[model samples]
Target chain A: MIIAVASGKGGTGKTTVATSLALVLGNRAQILDCDVEEPNCHILLKPTILTTDTVNLPVPSVDLEKCSLCGKCGEVCQFSAIVLIGKTILTFPELCHGCGSCSILCPEKAIREIPRNIGVIETGFVKDLDFVQGRIRIGEAMSPPLIREVKTKINRDKIAILDSPPGASCPVITTVKNTDFVIMVTEPTPFGLNDLEIAVEAIKGLRIPMGIVINRSDIGDSSARDFCNNNGLPLLMEIPHHRKVAEGYAQGAPLIESMPGYGHKFKKLSDDIQMIISESYEGASI
Target chain B: MKIAVTSTGKTIESAMDPRFGRAPYILIVDDNCNLIEAIDNSANVNAFRGAGIQAAKAIADRKVDMLLTGRCGPNAFTTLEAAGVKVGIEQSGTVREAVERVKKNEVSIADKPNAEAHW
Candidate 1:
């Protein structure tokens, strides 16, 4: 089953939960860090990258030689990436979404797609667990494309865990889409609860079965719990705020390895997820 | 020469808008500083992306010789420049005042984009 770990707010322990769960699942699980902008799971997992592939986006390249400034390519481009100004045709590679509309619709066929490197995808393994991640190039505004590239590395035979980026935006949507379930990590604060509500709305729209895992569950207000209770949403697990856990995380140590008995807790969490998935499958079959 | 000035309203007396891409109005004027017409630019205000390019196309379609605005992004600048439209940056005051400034050659045409892409 493909499970996505996500949070609407940043620094809410998405990496912590995803790494710990992968550790507990061991060889049975493959973890993909789809947070292309700033992937932190590598810091925790430290997988020795076996293979690296550069991700490229097909951007438009105009052949001025074969040119007719018929303005057809410009007219067909919704992105305004290409425009015919008098006899000159201007193409903005950054603005192009690589839709190939301009090339396809060009009367003169002066446009050709050129691969532009946007990011890199690395596949490796941590101990026995398969690991993959996508790191977007700096100053790249688009992360969804790279995230999609990372998802393609998912192994269907293993339990795939996707560590999604923060916010309920396009990147987050791309990471969470087509997952069997979602574990939303949130802190027990007003800010966390508000963002979690937005995330919950987004997930509900996708009709994905999701549960909340409240990180630092003891310090903040119980509003998150209350919100979950009111909404009848499942509260999967809670990781308390502890000095040792924090220090271990800072030292790039997995929670299951650093904290005593936490391996059992993560195992329980994994089993609970499996139970839910099986129950849902049974319900669907019935 | 016809010029387009980014404006906050649909009249020559309206205050000049600082933003070129998301400006509410584009007031077209003739060489004598007479108001030609105001084109609404509100459609680009909420554009998902590429507002500058769309706004530049809108102004270029009006067949204006010059653009007067507070700032122009790189994409819009290139589009306008390629269209042979001279851009006057840091334009302020009312639309009429901006037009008068342009006529008096008080606002010099920008050599490059004055602002980075905000989006």
Candidate 2:
């Protein structure tokens, strides 16, 4: 089963929960970090990367030699990445979505696609657990492409636990899409609750079964729990505020290593998620 | 020489638009400041990205010798330069006033983009 660990607000312990889940599952799981912008799974897991694949988006390259400034290339481009201005054909590579429309529609066939490096996908092994992460090239605005590349590394035979980027944007959606269940990590504070609500709304639109895991559950008000109760979302786990957990995280230690007792808790969380998925499928069939 | 002034309205009497790419209208005028055409730029104005580049292309297609606007971004500036169109940026007032300023060589043509890209 493919499960995505996501949160709308940053610093809500998504990486913490994700890493722990992967650790608990061990050889039975492959953790894919889809947070291309800032992947922290590697920091926790410290996987020795076996292979690094550079991901590229096919941007348009114009051959002015074969040249006719037919304006069709400009007309077909929605992002205005390629435009025919007077006798000059200008291409802004940064604005290109790598849609290849400009090249395909060019009657003169003056446009061809060239590889533009957007990011890299690194695959490695963390002990018995398989590890994969995508890191976007610095200053690269587009990350959905790279996130999609990371998801391609998902092993169907193993339980894929994806550590999604923070937010309800395209990157998070791309990571969460096609998952069997989503475990949304959140805090009990107002900021966490607000963003979690937004994220839950996005997940609801996708019609995916999701549950909440409230980190630092002891400090903040009970609003997060109240929200889950009102929305019929299962409160999967509540990790109380703990100094040791924080220090261990800062030292790049996985949650399971910091607090060995939580290993069983994470395992239970996975089992609960599995049961929910099965029940949903049974309900759908009936 | 045909000149285009970014404006908020169709006529030369209208206020000059400070924005280049997202300007609502572009009023084309002759050397003597006679209104030739008013090109609606709503498409570029509402564009999600690369608004300046598309707007520059539209103006270049009109075969304008000069463009008088509030500011020019890098992509738009580069496009206009490639089209051999002189850009006179940071001109504000009525469209007619901007045209008159350029006619008298009051506003200097920019060598590089005066502003960052809108995108």
Candidate 3:
């Protein structure tokens, strides 16, 4: 199943949940870190990357010599990334969303599309589980393309554990859309509860079934759980605040592997999720 | 045109509307730097992750010619430059002061992305 593990707020243990699930699921699973801007799952997994692919966005290139500055391209571009002066068709590749609307609407055909590298997607294997991550170029801001690139590395046979970036905005939406299941990790804090509402709305918009996992459950009350219960969303797991876990995290280690006693618990949670999603797809194992 | 300005919170309050969502509020301003809207979008502009597109449509709608703010990321800087909008920097005061400088054509843009990293 394609499971997107997400949290609207940063440092809320989304990566911890995603990587641990992948590690426990073994060869049956793969993990894609779609947090291209500042990906961190690879740091903990320490996978030996086997392949690397560059992610590029299509941007308009203006031919000043042959162009009549009619501003048609600019008019077509809702992004305002292209502006035509009296004789010059100015194109801003960075702001271009690669929608191809400008090129399609260009009457003079003076604008050609070119690839601008925005990021790189790398694939590796951690033991039996395959791993993929998108590394955004230092100056690039468009992460949706890179996230899509990272997702292309998924092997359908393996459990696809997607580690989404922290937000409820477009990037997070792009990562979470069409996933078989969604697992939202959150700390038991007011801020976590606040962002969780926005994330819930996004998932609802996608019409996808979702569950919750509470990290640092001991720090705050059960508001996250309360919201989930009130909303009829399942509360899959609640990991209490633990100093050892923090120490393990600081060392870039997976909790399931580091804390031996927790493996069965995570496995059970995985099995439950698989059972829920498996019914939806024929012959898919839970 | 409506413009989203990203700046230090200390000065943003004086010049922008008060609305908190994620973190760095997306201050929607008109051509005159008058507060028109505010959105919470710390993730979009926090480290300049997705500022260009997030603010592009709003600015385009306002017919703004310039984005007067503190620091801009490289992607946003180049994007705005290509769209023929002048980007100004280093002016610390109320939003009115920045708008005044923009009107006078005295504000200068950085050649590169000017955002400071939170890390």
Give fnat, all candidates: 0.50, 0.92, 0.00
Candidate 1 residue-wise lDDT, A109-188, digit = tens = 88889998899999999999999999999988878889988999989999999999999989999999999899999999
**Candidate 3 chain A minimal-lDDT segment of 10 residues:** A83-92
Q: What is the interface RMSD of each candidate, in Å?
A: 1.4, 0.9, 6.2
Candidate 2 per-residue C-alpha lDDT over B1-119 given as tens digits, one digit per residue, 9 for 90 to 100: 99999999999899999899999999999988899999999988888988898888888888899999989999999999999999998899999898888757799889999998767
- Model 1 shows how many backbone clashes? 0
Ranking by lDDT: 2, 1, 3
lDDT of 1 by residue, B5-119 (tens): 9999988889999999999898899977788988888888888667888888777777889999999999999889878889999989998899899768899899999899876
RMSD to the native, candidate 1?
A: 1.6
- Candidate 2: TM-score? 0.98
How good is the docking of model 3, as DockQ? 0.07
Tens-place lDDT digits, model 3, residues A111-228: 7889999988898899988888999999887888888778777788778999999989989988988788999998878999999888888888987778999999989777998999
Each prediction's TM-score versus the true structure? 0.95, 0.98, 0.72
Candidate 3 ranges beyond 4 A from true positions? A279-286, B1-119
Question: 1 or 2, which is superior by TM-score?
Answer: 2
Q: What DockQ does each candidate score versus the true complex, computed on alpha carbons?
A: 0.63, 0.84, 0.07
Comparing to the true complex, what docking class would candidate 1 get?
medium
lDDT of each: 0.90, 0.92, 0.76
